[model samples]
Target: MHASAHVDTFARDHLPPPGQWPGLHFDLPELRYPARLNAAAELLGGGVPERPVFRTPAGPPWTYGELRARVDRLAHVLTGELGVVPGNRVLLRGPTTPWLAACWLAVLKAGAIAVTVLAQQRPRELRTMCAIARVGHALCDVRSVGDLAGAGIPGLRIAVYGGDAPDDLLNRRADAGPFPAVDTAADDVALIAFTSGTTGRPKGCLHFHQDVLAIADTFSRHVLAPRADDVFAGSPPLGFTFGLGGLLVFPMRAGASALLLEQAGPRQLLAAIAAHRVSVLFNAPTAYRAMLGGLDGHDVSSLRRCVSAGENLPEATWRAWHERTGLRLINGIGATELLHVFLSAADERIRPGTTGVPVPGWRARVQDGNGDPVPDGRPGLLAVRGPVGCRYLADPRQREYVRDGWNVTGDTYVRETDGYFRYVARADDMIVSAGYNIAGPEVEDALLRHPDVVEAAVVGRPDEARGRVVVAFAVLRPGARPDAEALRAFLTAELAPYKCPREILFLDALPRTATGKLQRFLLRARGDTGVDTDGDQQ
Candidate 1:
């Protein structure tokens, strides 16, 4: 089936070669969508009109009807006023705000592909995305407009929001009638989400219009089982896929409201949950761990469902949270290439250490280097195929990701006899020391069990005797100081001798990306500087 021709074929033309794409499966009846569909219409156009759609601490609540009107008006401004045409890539850079959410919906409503970037990104990163996507138009937060301007993309048109600006999106005429959503094909590229690029240059993950709703219908509908009355809250920036699904798509799909906080730390998130009566929480394990320290002061009884992704959730963290709140952390493993969670379990089905079975409408397996299924309980590459899969825009690495009709995520895992998948490490993260293969996350998980350790990241350093030696960077809990020898001894009780860290370096905090994922590559860069003999210093 040929996709409906887009006005600007830049994105379609640059998609990975047809044969390199994973075999997308939508066999489930609910997964089947019409050939001509607009995700913006499906996600935001049909909801409880009088029900609140978004609420912030200081801003007035926006009902579904109000958000729809704002989106329609913005669509008119983009098409009628700014002359945006179908297939045009519009860059969106901003914090998590109602305006930013409306702008994203408006871009899709206007038949343009949305290219979102974190507001915290520097000029260099912005330039890279702009050049790669060939962006000609942008909607930026007022505070980030200067950085967007510094990107120096030729012929770029930008409109700022959230502050006084001559060309602010909020200032656009709202008197116009509702602008009709564009009739985009189901397979038409709707978003170009760039990867976090911790190891290398960020690659654009092109998602189709149908891919947007697939995540909500499959994961949110089946795994999360959200209700229309649930109020969602989270810390991930909207630019990230995890955040997009958590804060917007999932809630909107369930006809629920989302609490959009511009800036959310552990403290602020806890306060919002109590103040707004938020019931559904989504954040990384690090944020959850941080919140554990302050849980005594807040009434988080309002939160019924807590979702953790973006990084592996250690069993220690999961057990601690469950023990305290009587709510099991719903751990999921997803990637930008696949849109959202594909492996997860909710409620009673959740197993503390394993990242649940394949989500409904998806299939997963562990495969060896030759693309054959590995034996159960043996570690190998994780491969998945489902309603949503990878399609990198013009990246040569596309060939490496999709093999034998499966999206070979760079993660290593072991599938148990009962079909539960346990994460071992990233394919590139396994450390080989003296003929022993060790997963860095396993060691980090062990260190986190220590009472004084708040956060831990482990990497391998080159050694003269052994090929590599495990090293760890730890963040101590407030007012708790533990020496390196004590941490090592603590690890000795929990981990095998070969799996323990050779040295532990204390830092104020572990380096992480905007989305709270630890940057092990950065730690590896510092690992070769020689192990610090003295412990409690940054």
Candidate 2:
């Protein structure tokens, strides 16, 4: 690797062994980046200085020149007054807004590794992520600093933004001149994205400067092609790579603008599409399904492209939206490890029930348990190889995710003869509810903390409105009665609201195998209903 600009070298030292990495391919011409590159510099430099690049509902649009100046001043503050150096992990906590986006860019510009987390995360979740990433400095929005403060990370320096406090980030004194971009190596780590802890412990996925740009060149440039005049908006939080790519990176790479919304429900998205003339949209199937029934009087004629992910898009949902709007939904599947979508279909190439072929710089296939290639029509593991792949920070699970030069995503799929991939189901026990990946064991652990709870198990049950809802079965102590709301309230204080169980059922005892192992499969089969240990309905 080229000489890195990072002085601390913590992120580089924690990366998985070189031999454990998946095969990387820079096949496309645009995928090849220079040895010395800064992703923030690359993204911000592409836009025309006079054109608007970011917009909020109540605030005026910020053009490229204005945004650049803000980033430069923030970068100066980060390095000059805050005593930040290259390779420092700076945590960004806030809602999705222009200031949050600017803070992310400024961290990259100052040669620091960004650790962005969701605003809805509780103190427990925040503490775990910050511990894993070894975060020292934090820049949080004034409204969202309460949780981060509650996290109680020792020796963490906190700075508030978007507030009138004396020590606010915008109030810091710094030079207004342009700050030279850090001469970071293309392979140097730029950010560490933590998974939702699908396995009960969040793993940080380290992405390099070039990897950040590669996702844009492959997916945004090849599949969901955007025009400079387009306005992008999405529902996913910027903490999720889905939102990071669709709402910010992809649009900025194409010299387009984006409208950032703090609360983007179906109704809000529809209103924004009409109010801002949004052209390109990114959301999950659940939102699209909800919007189908309320399209009357909403002027969505400006929307030309819609991208859906985070959950499987049903044929029924796709057909209803297409029929209502005369626009085909681009269904794709992506993982946090891979950074962005590698398989997608757009425009005339879309098939209603299948994910399209691999993007221009990616290759994908189905493989069996032993890592052997499966037949075209057989269901197996989805294995993909691309320029951007997984690199876990000090996590031993790297062995399970990458095998034989391919990243084996824990999703079962079948590749057809025509090269289209069909989604089957998740191969693991992780529950995906309402486009959010919620770990059953994590919720179970939270439930077990209650004094009345003896044993607990969580599963995902299909729901018409949310695609799936978290259903939990608990075996309470003998005198305790079943009160779902009480247990839900107990969980809300510890975990994110989305991770709380939507429905709780009482069971005499949790089912187990002969060796005393949890039989989650049995619970999944008996979802939404409680059954006694004797296999009889309660």
Candidate 3:
């Protein structure tokens, strides 16, 4: 792992650091591509037309040449017909369609920052994001055009991609082209990605010209490692960094193929992979588990890598997948603040349950309550620092994120002796009872080990005196009926009395974000945490 090992790679060196650390190898020069064009410009430099760049469910396959052609036409229309001036924010909203991809590239090339808003978001959420981004225009699907029309944002121009365009706006036309690339600096703000604000309101995370350098060098280098001929496909939408990177940037950057499905469910994902012969697979653990049964009829041997992130990777889920597929599921954690997971490992020798070491160009540490360094193998707040940093637009949360320069992610983890960090759940997700502080995930992991459990989410519920008590939500596999009394008896034997949930709530499904993360904040709203407290000493 010498610094010189990655010296010649295009994306390996990016950060401001100069000399390399042989102890933990990193190269600053190779970490980024030169900030010539926006994210779209850097990705489409690969000169090929027939080579697949993006594949949609209903339309023709967009190759490197075809994607670039479409982008050129779209940028031409956006500049000529739509009058999209530079620095103007365009709210690119929709599913992962070819039109959206073309629109995203057009917005960036038009010298406007592309603001991708997910379709799953409520109207209120859309209004909030649009207002914050100062959105001058919106490129959405046909279904959402009307919803956004009545959103009450004044004079916000709306253009439906592939659907009917507004009267003044023009769709794909004969009179558009001769588009020129905008000269953008490395520090120019490229995107304002939103982190799910479970605690309160969503915060805007800004990424500059050099940001994609880290996404490709660090994330792509470590996780997917896609090649030119390889075909990429995944379950996440283009709006999510998971989908944007996994399905779009990573593949197109290397001149690989991307299958962009507008409807990315368990069935569509499997069918697309088998139909398109997708090489790289990226989705949540729940998606992987749900698709396990569907793999029997599909020839999915094209899958080279399967990346799991956005939630804690339970041990049972990981093992079950391995037993079924004989392929390793790469696990990592990413926050919108950091843009993506700065830490991940793809190669073998990966420990079963540990989130592997930090990827190149990033550094992480576990810190104490006072932000001091914590001892190894002890759980503490996870703090990270690298090329990307958090910037909450006009929000005081920025003060909470930056501490002595490092971004203090709201995650609790323990760095084991081998340098791997084991995720213990979010810091707020910890439960305290009597005196000892117990992590809800620990109990959930114990329950998942019971074999009958298919999915689990542990949360701290309200308690009368001890503040909050442990509560468990369990989703059992079909044909296995493990009742509350029997499961509680089993958990009591394995866990400390105070740590075990006083009650278990059964559910067929859990609330989750589009990226496949459990929305534990919902559990808190449900007020499910209560202790038995049957005359037991407190």
lDDT string for model 2 (1-538, tens) is 7999999899999989989999999999898889999999999999999999999999789999999999999999999999999999999989999999999999999999999888888898889888889999999999999989977998889999999987899998999999999999999999999875433688999999998899999999999889999999988878888889998899999999999999898899999999999999999775786687579999999999999987667666677789999999999988889998999999999998787899899999999989999999987899999999998999999999999889999888889999999876567766778788776656776776676876677888878888888888887766887788898899999799998987787788776521123566677778846554334676
Question: Which 10-residue window in model 1 sums to the lowest lDDT?
Answer: 529-538
Q: Can you list the residue pairs that collide in candidate 2?
A: none
List candidate 3 stretches off by more than 4 Å: 1-26, 32-37, 164-176, 479-482, 528-538
List residue ranges in candidate 2 displaced over 4 A: 197-199, 429-538
Best by TM-score: 1
Q: Point out the worst 10-residue segment of candidate 3 by lDDT.
A: 1-10
Ranking, lDDT, top scorer first:
1, 2, 3
Judged by lDDT against the true structure, how good is candidate 2?
0.88
Show where candidate 1 strays beyond 4 Å.
531-538
CA lDDT, candidate 2, residue 401: 97
Question: How well is each residue in 155-215 modelled by candidate 1, as lDDT tens digits?
Answer: 8999888886666778866556878888899989999999995868889999999999999
Give the local distance difference test score of model 3: 0.73
Q: What is the lDDT of residue 269 in candidate 2?
A: 93
Best by lDDT: 1
The Cα error of candidate 3 at residue 246, in Å, is 0.8
Error of 3 at 333 (Å): 1.1
